[model samples]
Each structure stands twice: as structure tokens, then as C-alpha cells.
Target: MNAPITIDTPRTRISALATDHTALLLDYRLRNRDHLAPSEPARGAEYYTEQAVASRIAQVEAEAEAGSALHLAALDRASGQLVALCSFTNIVRGPFQACHLGFSVDHAHEGSGLMAEVAGAGINYVFDQLRLHRIMAAHMPRNERSAGLLARLGFEREGYARSYLRINGQWEDMVLLSLVDDRPGA
Candidate 1:
């Protein structure tokens, strides 16, 4: 499914993460490692390796096929480099139609609205194509950028959680937010 789903935007090309595309993913991760380390969970050295990325991509592909999750890579078409990534994970169907959203963009692309461009399209795909009712996203309380981005995406503040996640090795508090598909028949 990841290999087949692709969305082309005016400034970027968004495609599902595929195992065969390890080179692009590896390049992106390597380039953004320092830039993304703050908000991301602490990872071992192996996490940055091509073999690790390929293995992760393979897992995502399997999850996509099973209708549980999707990981998308956003590329700057003009520069031909990956600029961002977003994932819809922990997808639950049946009566509980929902998933969690997580994303990161190149440091250079920050404040350029690339994350919004990619994540907005991803949210639409999740709501319309996947028919999920809700998307939950959380960010460190100190990260105003993420808070603003989630607000702009129509994700209302839900609550706060203490030590909600481990980021940069230590436990961190999170400001929870959620966006619900409220369109008619959703």
C-alpha cells in the first residue's frame, strides 16, 4: 500500500515510506539527526543505520498492508531531498476509529510551513481515505512551535500528561491535543 500511495503537492512530493527507498530515508535521517534529536525519543546508534531504517520501513509497510498505520516521507521536489516525515500510528478501527500523529521536518525547512503542508495532507488522507474519526497528537510543553502547529491544524487542547513520553533520554511532560473529523457522515 505504501508503494502505491503518492501525493504530489506544489512544492513537495509526498509518498509512503517504502523499504526499497532506504537511501533517501537514510540520507534524510542523517542530515537531520541533530536537528530532530530534541523532540524525538532517544535512540541507540543503530537507529541511524541504513539497515535499521530499512527494517523500520519494512515494518511500516506491513502495518500499512494490515490497515494499522502509515508513514509518509515528504521530499522537496526541486532539490530532490527529503524534507519531512509524518506517521499515523496506533490506528484502531471498528468502534474506536482513531490514530496518533507524529511528525518531524528538516531544520532548514522550519517556519517555512513544510510540516503543515505535509501534515495537513496526511490528516486529510487519514480522515477521508482511512475514515478515521480522530487523530491524537502530543508535544513537549516547552515546544511552542509544535503547539502552534497542532492548533493551526484544528487540534484542540485536550489535557496535559506528566512524563508522557521519553524524549532525548529523559521523561518529559506533554500537552495533549486531538482533531476530530466533524464533517457530515464522518
Candidate 2:
């Protein structure tokens, strides 16, 4: 409920998306659609349409406004351009103060450790500032890079979900990874 977490990097920062950032958001989403497609099979060229993107943006903002979840936009600190996105979604408050974490980086920025850096910052905010106990990441088994990043970030492989979600048009399995706040008695 505190201000949404802002992640700062040497060259960029990740902050909540403002409605006025439509242009940047659309560009980021469209530009990264290819890089993100493999991981997010549900996305397609049609999915990147402005109407669809705007609807999703509205949904995210509504969720944030309702105290349900937070969506942070990764911006190049120098140019002030959106390059990526990371979000905590489907948040449940109360005893289950937890949510699903998901992200995508512009292909131009991949292999630069930017995703991991952003994730570390976002996870810290969820655990420390938001006081959440757990953040879950689900990825397809074929996404070796994503799995590796989760492991490197200290998230444990929790389990596997069969047909966890629909990717593109087919049901796919997901490897569930979790990061827990193990701070003494936390």
C-alpha cells in the first residue's frame, strides 16, 4: 500500500506506469513482442493492437488503484524511454499477501543482466516495502534462461503445473519458482 517500488539501475529505473506514458508503453510492447512471444505465447501481433494494449493498461492501473497489485515500467533513466516491464499480478491481501511476478525485456536489452537486476529490485520491494511473504514466477520448461535467472536470484523450484496456462492456443506446463522472505520469523 506504500508507494509502488521504484527500481534504480546505473542507466535506468523501473517505476509505476503513468497513464500519460501510453506512447512509450505501446512502443515497448510492440517492439518487444517478438522477444516476448516465445515466453508469452499468448501474445501475437493482434495482441499488440493499441486497443488491446490500452485495455490491459487500464486493467493494471485499476488493480493498482484497488491495492491489489503493482505494475512497474522499466525506463531508460537517461532517455526516459520505457524498455521493459515487470509486474506483480493477481495479488491477494490478508493472510495470503502474495502475488504472481512476471516480466519482459526489450530484445535490445537482453543478455545485459537487466532483467535480473530489475527482478532483484522488484523482489526486494515486494518483500521489504510491501511486506509480502512470497512472490511466484511461472515459466515454461523450455524457457531455460528464465529458469536460470530465477535460480540465480535465489528462488527455489516449488513445483510443476500441468497445463498451467494457455500459451498461444495450446495449453502449456509451467515450472513454478518461488522467492520467500526468510528473514528471521518473517
Candidate 3:
């Protein structure tokens, strides 16, 4: 397996999720459940349990080892609190070197640009280290904050899909966006 990646920003440290971080992840998810409900699907009771989080961490670690996914957490430098989560999921190699990105920031850290900071680092790793060609992100039409963040990350609007995903128990329309690695020979 590749060495764990860590990116230190001005205010936070973004590191690849590991089994040891399961408790922190569970705490962050539980604390932000209400804040994230509008944008995320409802989680089952077990989702908040330590056992489930540990299993998830193990699965994510396995996927990272297999080159299929990268899951990272942004933690506050001083407080050691999880501030955001970023994931490059469903990674496809060979000719289709791309992945779908999913992310969310803690409510307490919203509008602080921490998500952008961490996501930028994650994207760099995806492009430079992983040598992926494209990264795609989708957001509900009403999610202005996500749209703005994606724009700042240089993603272009690709299209829109009706009922692109189920969120909060209902089908949500999504605006699809993608960022292509334009570096030479990428």
C-alpha cells in the first residue's frame, strides 16, 4: 500500500482516512447530521456507531490500497477536530482515469474556505500522485456554496441531470461538473 498522504494547510491538516480516525469521523458525522441532512441522504442507526465507522474506515483503506478510492479528512490543527470530509470515489483507471468527488464541511466551519483548502490538496494528489485525468463533482441546483467551491476549483459545468441522486429521501436534481487535468501528457 502507498504511504499515507497528508497535506497541511494554514488552518487544518488533511490526511488520508485511517482506522485510527474512525472515532473522530463518527463524532464529526454525528455533530453535523442535522446540518448535512438537506444535502445528504439519511443515515441508518448503525452509521453512527463505532463498529460501523471502523468497518467503513477499513473498507476505505482497502479501496485506497487497491487504487479505487481516496477518502480524506480535514482536521483543525489546534483542536484536532474534524472540519471536513473529502472523497474521490468510484475511480476508474486505464483509458478512463477519473473519479467522482464527494465532500462536506462541518457546519461550524462553513464559509471558512477550509473545504476549498483541503479539497485543493486532495485534487492535487489525485492528479499528480494518482495520475488521474479527470475529477467530477455534482451538486444540487440549490446548493450555491458547493457550486461556488467547484468553480473555484476550476471545474466546468458539464450538464445537468434530473434525479441524479437521492438525498433526504427524495430524488434531487444535480448540476454535473468536471475538472480535467490539463498538464502536459496527463
Candidate 4:
């Protein structure tokens, strides 16, 4: 299995979390609870606890060891505060060679192109490091920000799904998009 990766962008340092960063995960979750509550499922207050975040960190790290998934966090280069997160989950190798992408940005960094900067790096890592042939992402129909970002990233519109996911206790329609890596030997 490959080790967790770290990349330095112009304004942020992006890397996967380790088991020791439980407090950092807790703080990031608590700070973004309100900002992320809409699209994510409710995990109650317990989910924001340090123990829970530690367990989750362990879980994702194990998945990384298994080559099944990864979660990359981007920290501000100056302050070291987490500014964004990108997850590439459900990695299927064999003949599929694909995975699902999810992301969120700090509300303070919204509209500042931070997500694009971080997510672009994540996508490149997925393709180059993971050697995945394709990456899939979906966003709610009302989320024009996500739609525009995916478009700018060159993800093609795959198809619209009706009630594709149960988000925030409600079934929501999703606009699915995908990007394929067509480089030599991909």
C-alpha cells in the first residue's frame, strides 16, 4: 500500500490526516458544522467529539492502507488552519479503476477559489498516484458553485439522477459529472 501523500500549493499544504491529529479534526468539524450541515447527513453532537473524529481518522487511514480511499485536508500555509477537504472514496480497481469525489471548503474561504486550488491537486493525486482512470462527483442541483467548479475542471456531465442521495434527512436530486484520465497508459 502507498503511504499518505503531502503536497504544497501556493497558499496551502495539502495532506492526509494521521491518527495524532484528532484535536485538529475535532476543531475543523465543529467550526464547519453549521457550514456543512446542509449537504451532509446528521451525526449528532457526538460526531463532533474528539473520540469520534479520532475513530474516523483511524478508519480513513485504514482505508488508505487498503487502497480503498483517501481524505486530503488543505491547511493554510501561514496559519496552518484547515481550509478545505477533498475525499476520494469507494475506489474500485480491477477493471473499473474509478472512485467518487467529495469536497468542502471553509466558509471563510468560499468564493476565493481555494476549493479549486485544493481539489485540483487532489484530482491530480488521484489520477497520478492512485492511477485511477476516472473520478466521479455529484452535487445537488441547486449547488451552482459545485456545478461550475466541476465544469471548470473539465468534468463532463454524465447524467442527472433522481433522489440520488439522502442528504440532511432529505432525498435530493444530483447532477453527476465525471473526469477521465486519458494520458498514456492510464
Q: Candidate 2 regions off by >4 Å?
A: 2-5, 44-46
lDDT of each: 0.90, 0.82, 0.93, 0.89
* TM-score, per-candidate, Cα-based: 0.96, 0.91, 0.96, 0.96
* Per-residue lDDT of candidate 4, residues 43-73 (tens digit): 6879988889889999989988888998888
Ranking by lDDT: 3, 1, 4, 2
Question: Cα RMSD (Å) between model 3 and the true structure?
Answer: 1.1
**Candidate 1 runs further than 4 Å off:** 1-3
Which candidate, 1 or 3, has the higher lDDT?
A: 3
Question: Clash number for every model?
Answer: 0, 1, 0, 0
Q: Which residue pairs in candidate 4 collide?
A: none
